[model samples]
Target: MILGYSVTDLVGFFAKGLDQVINVVIMFIFAIIFFGIMNDSGLFKPLVKRLILMTRGNVVIVCAMTALIGTIAQLDGAGAVTFLLSIPALLPLYKALNMNKYLLILLLALSAAIMNMVLGEVQWLV
Candidate 1:
C-alpha cells in the first residue's frame, strides 16, 4: 500500500510463488497417481514374490535387497516418491520373513542419502 502496488500485482506475486513450487507439486501428484494405480493393479505383488523367492527367506539377502531397491527408488530424487514406491512393496516381505522394520527405514534412508550425495556431486561436476 505504501508503495502504491495494485491488488492485482499482489495476487500475481502469490501466483509467482506457486510457480516456483509447481513442479514439485506436479511431481508429487503424478507420483501418487502412478503408484496408486500400480499398487491397485497388483503389479507389486508379483515383484515382491519374486524378491522373496530370490532371497529364500534369508535375512541378509532381504536386507541387501532392501538397500538395493531403496537406492533404485531414490533415483527419482524425491523421498516421498521413493517411499511410496518402496515401502508398500517391501512391507509384506518384511512381515512374512519377520525382519526388523527399523532396518527397512534405515536402509532406505541410507541408500537415499548415498544416492542424493552422489547425484549432488555429479550435478556439481557437470
Candidate 2:
C-alpha cells in the first residue's frame, strides 16, 4: 500500500505519463520525416557545398561561419533544433577537411550558449 492506497488502487497511477511519452514519440517521428524529406530534396546539400567552396578550405572561416550559423539557427528558440539544423548541414564539410568533429560541436555549443545568455531567455526564466 502507498499512503493508505491499496496496490490495486495504484495500478493506474503512472498511466498519465504514458500519454506524454506517446506524444513525444509522435513528435519525433514527424520531425524525422520532415528532415528526411528535406535531405532528399537536395536543398541543404547545395548550400553546404557552396559554403565549403567559398571558404576555400580555411578552418578558421569555417569555424566562424559554423558559429554564426549555429547562433542564427537558435533564433528558433531551441538549441536542440538549432543543432538538428546545423550539424547535419555542417558535418560533411568537417569530414571532408579532416577537421575535428568535437571542435565543430564546441564552437556551435559555445555560440549557442552565448546567444542564449545575451538574449535573456533561458537564464531569465530560471
Candidate 3:
C-alpha cells in the first residue's frame, strides 16, 4: 500500500513538472514566431545594414560602435537581442584581424555585464 502511494505521488510531481516545461516551450514558440514575422517584414534589417555600411573601412570605429550597440541593447531590456545583433558583426572583424574568438567573446560578455549593471538602476526606477 505504501509503495503504491509513493508511486502515485511521484507521478503527480512528474506531471506538474512536465506541465511547467510545456508552458515554457509554448511561450518560446510564440516569441520565435513573432520575431520571425518582424524579421521577414524587414523591420530590423535596414537599420542593421545601415550601421554596417556606416562602419565600413574603420576598424576602431566599428569596435566602438559594436560596444555602443551592446550598451544600447541593455536599455532595450533583452540581453539576447543585443547579443544577436552584435555577434554577426563581430565575427567578420574577428576573422579578418585573426583575433582570438574566445577573447572577443569574453570582451563582449564583459561589456554586456557592465551595461546590465548600469541598466539595473533604471529598473529600480520603474
* Candidate number of the best TM-score: 2
Q: What TM-score would every model get versus the actual structure?
A: 0.64, 0.64, 0.51
lDDT of each residue in 1-126, candidate 1, tens digit only: 679989999999999999998987887788778767877787777776887788887899888888999999999888877887787778767967788889999999999999999989998999
Best by lDDT: 1
Model 3, 79: alpha-carbon shift in Å?
1.7
**Please, what are the lDDT tens digits per residue for candidate 2 over residues 3-92?**
898766676665666765786567667877876787678667777678778998899999999999989988766786787778777876
TM-score of 1: 0.64
- lDDT scores of the candidates, listed in order: 0.85, 0.81, 0.67
lDDT of 3 at 1: 44
Error of model 2, residue 62, in angstroms:
0.5
Candidate number that wins on lDDT, 2 or 3? 2
Decide which is better by TM-score, 1 or 2.
2
Candidate 3: the clashing residue pairs are none
Question: Which RMSD does model 2 reach against the true structure?
Answer: 4.3
Off by over 4 Å in 1: 1-50
